[model samples]
Target: MIDKDRDTKKLQWNIGTGVHYTLNANWALQADWKYNYHRNTGARDRLWGTRLIYRFGEGNKYI
Candidate 1:
């Protein structure tokens, strides 16, 4: 059984990036994601997700 009455310090940090496909100058589709790594334990965490981006005016576009 899992401990329901426990206090665990899940201290970690995240640092990552992903490539994206530019559908247009205003819209884009990307595989944007990130990860969390435990600082003290050196254990990797599966803390990542997807994102949708919309831009106004051209600046730094990626594909």
Candidate 2:
């Protein structure tokens, strides 16, 4: 038995999406995806990530 004015109040939400491809001037490739929602009790989460970029000694000069 526990119910001492329980009202913490909780709400969470998140969404994200990204993609960038530029296989030139050096090398660049990235991909990301994320989605999360937690309302009341219905909890759900999903995340994805991928990245492979490299640039050294002046690579991309606003190209």
Candidate 3:
């Protein structure tokens, strides 16, 4: 279940950048950084995160 009113009237901002490189013929590595901002109920929050990804196949994926 979901609440529409609770989901609405909220403001958020997000920015992200990522890079990928092949470490070997069968593997690749990726890194990413993200920043997020949320405002609600007269309060504001800023969050950031970093992620590292490894792939077994030819293509790399990140989140």
Tell me the TM-score of each prediction against the true structure. 0.44, 0.36, 0.51
Q: Where's the lowest-lDDT run of ten residues in candidate 3?
A: 42-51
Candidate 3 ranges with C-alpha deviation above 4 Å: 1-8, 41-63
- Winning candidate number (TM-score): 3
In model 3, the clashing pairs are: none
CA RMSD of all predictions:
7.8, 7.5, 6.8
Candidate 1 residue pairs that clash: none
lDDT of 1 by residue, 1-63 (tens): 246534454668987888777677777667756787886689886645565778877834653
Candidate 2 Cα deviation (angstroms), residue 10: 14
Q: lDDT for each of the candidates?
A: 0.69, 0.87, 0.61
Using lDDT as the measure, the top candidate is: 2
**Cα lDDT tens digits for candidate 2, 1-63:** 245445566788999999999888788999999999998889998999999999998889787
Which scores higher on lDDT, 1 or 3?
A: 1
Off-target runs (Cα >4 Å) in candidate 2 are: 1-12, 25-28, 51-63
Compared with the true structure, the alpha-carbon lDDT of candidate 3 equals: 0.61
Model 3: number of backbone collisions? 0
